[model samples]
Target chain A: MVVAEVSIVPIGEGPSVSKYVKKAIEVFKKYNLKVEPHAMGTVLEGDLEEILEAFKEAHREVLKDSKRVLSTLKIDERTDKENTIERKLRAIGIE
Target chain B: MVVAEVSIVPIGEGPSVSKYVKKAIEVFKKYNLKVEPHAMGTVLEGDLEEILEAFKEAHREVLKDSKRVLSTLKIDERTDKENTIERKLRAIGIE
Candidate 1:
């Protein structure tokens, strides 16, 4: 499994962007991937290709309403063991 | 031009991972991309392809020294106008 954190920003969209973020979240949900939203970005867990596909879908979804879209993706894939958001946090003693 | 914020973490490397981060930053610098290190990640400004290439290089550099690497990239690209880190923060009144 891979964990990806993604942030999509629509330029010139004024200050509020929660609506765009919500749209991206909906895309992730539709993909049936585990999603966790945080202050900076949203974390997703799924197969590597599925996560990338979801990221692209979310980016495209957000871009539809805005003139310019800027998106970021962070991927964490492990071959040694199963990795998840909760496990990552707990590893650092966050929970 | 584009602005990318990247964070690479080497899994199972305990709590301190600054050394790994430093390696990534060096790759960005070597690529001659403008880089700004932040609390959460590093912001880079350069051509989109260059930025992506540097990201890959950084990821590989860090991966060489660790077992598993997890990296995150956030890109802000604009075709309407030039985009930079300062302008982004200033747009939101951060000065």
Candidate 2:
């Protein structure tokens, strides 16, 4: 499983970006991936290709309204061990 | 408190990016931020200004060797609530 952390920032959009974020969340949900929306960004767990596809679609969705959009993505893929948001926190002794 | 999720990617760099990532992590550690390094990127918790300063320094550090670098940052600041990695996971019932 590939766990991706993504944050899409719409430049020039006022301080409030809940609308764009909501749309991005909708895209993530459409993928049927397990998503956890955090204060900073959203955590998604699924196949890498699916996650990348979702990212692209979400970027396009946001770009439709905003002139420029910055999407930050971090993908974690491990063949030896399964990784989830919960497991990552557990590895760091957060629990 | 502000929690920032940052991922620095050096474009054109070969598949191995551990060196650049290590430098970035060193910068994060120097700021005395509580950092949790995961598979994709590192999660940093500290004051907003301090986190931004660290990000700049880390970006510079990586740029010394790579020509093009992409840094993605997400900041989460909530005046009404104290947020932490643990709290975030707990909010989603991960724990």
Candidate 3:
């Protein structure tokens, strides 16, 4: 599995962007991926392809409202080990 | 409070970057911030200034071993409402 952290910013959108972010979160839900929404971005865990697909969909969704959108993504994939957001936190003694 | 999700990639580093990421995580801990380590990067919640300071320190720490480093940060700050990673998840119907 590959874990992706994605932040989509809709530029030119006024001060608050909760509405756009909420829509992106809905896209994640539609993909049936395990999502953990943080204040800045959302963490998604799933197969690499699925995660990428979801990101594309989310980008499209956000673009519907804003003329310009900036999406940043960081993907972590380990072939030797299986990792998840929860497992990573546990490994670092977070919980 | 502001939440920042940062991912620091040490360019030219071989396939595995766990060592560098581990060092960065230590920097976040040293700053006494609540950190959640994910597969791709780490989520830190703290005052804006403190978070930026930690990122600076982590960048320096990562640079000790890596000749080149790329750090990406997304900050979400809302003056009208208090927000947090956990709270965001809860608002999205995730616990």
Between candidates 1 and 3, name the one with more favorable DockQ: 1
Off by over 4 Å in 1: A1-65, A82-95, B89-95
Off by over 4 Å in 2: A1-3, A6-95
For every prediction, compared with the true complex, DockQ reads 0.43, 0.17, 0.41
Better of 2 and 3 by TM-score: 3
The Cα local distance difference test for each model comes to 0.82, 0.80, 0.81
- Give per-residue CA lDDT, model 2, range A1-95, as digits (tens): 88888888898777566678878888888996888776567889888889999999999999999989999887877666666767765553444
The best candidate by TM-score is: 3
Tens digit of per-residue lDDT, candidate 1, span A25-47:
98999886899999888888887
Quality of model 3 by C-alpha lDDT: 0.81
Q: Which ten residues in a row have the lowest lDDT in candidate 3 chain B?
A: B86-95
Candidate with the larger lDDT of 2 and 3: 3
Candidate 2, residue B72: Cα displacement in angstroms equals 1.6
TM-score winner between 1 and 3, please give it.
3
Clashes of each: 2, 0, 0
Residue range B1-95, candidate 3, lDDT tens digits? 88778878898788666678888888998886788776557888888899999999999899989989999777878787777877766665557
lDDT of 3 by residue, A1-95 (tens): 87788888898888667688889988988886788776567889988888899999999999999999999777887777776777766554555
Q: Which segments of model 3 are wrong by more than 4 Å?
A: A65-68, A77-95
- lDDT for B17 in candidate 3 is 69
Q: In candidate 1, what are the lDDT values of residues B1-95, reduced to their tens digit?
A: 67778889998778899999988888899986899999999989887667767877787688778778888877766667667877888999998
Chain B TM-score against the true chain B, candidate 2: 0.92
